[model samples]
Target: MKTCLPFFLTISLLIPAPASSAFYQWTDAKGVVHMTDDAHKVPKQYKGKATRIEVKEPARLPEAAPPEPGPAADLAAPAAGRGEASVPGGHDETWWRAQFGELRSELKTLQAARSQKEQKLVELRRRRAIFQRSRDRAAINEAEAQASADDARIGDLLNRIAALDLAASKAGVPAEWRQ
Candidate 1:
């Protein structure tokens, strides 16, 4: 009995479990079994024994609505009129007025910004001029000092040559031929 029990356990473990599907297997009136996705296909005799398989459907989302008109559309209509505008074009007065207000605000901002930039540019130009003058003065001073130093060096070299000639004369050497 114990050996038979092991065989039965192995056989049960080897058999695969039923797969998940939308179909079901049922036996018809003739006792022939068949698989089908539709429950109505099962014969009346197998309906009682047929197993039901559940199917999950994807969720559907609602569509979006069209956009509404802007504030300008409201402004073009006359005060007394309910649907159409009192004006000839039936345009919304509110929308035009809103646009005009936006333009005026933009113009004011631009004017303010322009004034600020102009003031900044003027100060920068003034500072640049001051810097240029300073730079020019420094260059002139440098050039003058360089010229004075060159003159001093030349004078020193002439004095050295004169001293050498004097020494050659005192030593009884021909100073003119002292190459």
Candidate 2:
């Protein structure tokens, strides 16, 4: 039994252990992405869209190697230390999302509002011009006030957008994401 125990130990040491984890990805109805290790946990409706992601075994290295030099490579240095990929300015994907996600949503809504106001503003300007030529004091004042209010509102929206842009630029956010 002692000799058999040694042989079994040797066999166990020689054999590789099977992988114990897996990952699956799916997007929900609200467009939020989800990831889980258990396939059975996913909803029945999402099963068709769920994708199995094979987790590759990390290569066993004797020593750490130096990263290559480049824009992305330079950025990867911080990401490596943080155990994740980052953008140019040492900010990871989650960080960027935290910073810009709500701003992006607000920006979209504001831009739409600005577009509608702009059209109304143009019409107001034309009406204001007509009122000016007619030289009617009360009508002219009302037209001018309406036009000014619209102009001021439009300016405010533009300044807010510009501020968002400036903040993104300072953070080294990508141009595509600035919108």
Candidate 3:
């Protein structure tokens, strides 16, 4: 009973932080509809017209652990990959389209790089014995180090893509736009 008390308390504390309860939308003088998580941000004049929309965000399941690499590209990596910087203009249609285009292009580039790295890593590992006998152990070590860096970079690219997807989902962008 004592252990369960702390566990329940922790869960209760964490639940409200990520799950936004409501969204407030109001129009500015320019007729730009602005949506925000905080009601306080709504202008005094527009408060009466502001719509308080209660949103029930979908439960996010914990990410599954990445599996070991296999002989083929059929593993769970995205058909495309991704890269740096957070996309902006959450509610703007033009921005959303631009963000989607940029993200998809970057993803494609990263995916190509990922494929190249996978091949390079394989070849490096395969030539381990040859490198060992050539008295160029440093070269082999350098290749191994590069492989590690490539893994980290590829992982980051994948994460950036996932974040974009999450942002799009939250903004209620069309599913087809993500493709």
Q: How many clashing pairs in candidate 2?
A: 0
In TM-score terms, which candidate is top? Answer: 3
The list of candidate 2 runs beyond 4 A from truth reads 1-10, 18-20, 60-64, 68-179
Worst 10 residues of 1 by lDDT: 58-67
Evaluated against the true structure, the overall lDDT of model 2 is 0.54
lDDT of 1 by residue, 1-179 (tens): 98999999999999987443355555566867687888888778776555433333322222221112344445544443565534222223354344345444543454344444444444555665677777555555555454344333333333333443343344343322344
What lDDT score is found at residue 167 in candidate 1? 39
lDDT of 3 by residue, 98-164 (tens): 4556656765575456456546655665676555555345655776566456445544544555665
lDDT scores for all predictions?
A: 0.46, 0.54, 0.55
- Rank by lDDT, highest first: 3, 2, 1
Which candidate achieves the best lDDT against the true structure?
3
For candidate 3, list the clashing residue pairs, or say none. Answer: 81-107
The residue-level lDDT of candidate 1 at 140 comes to 51
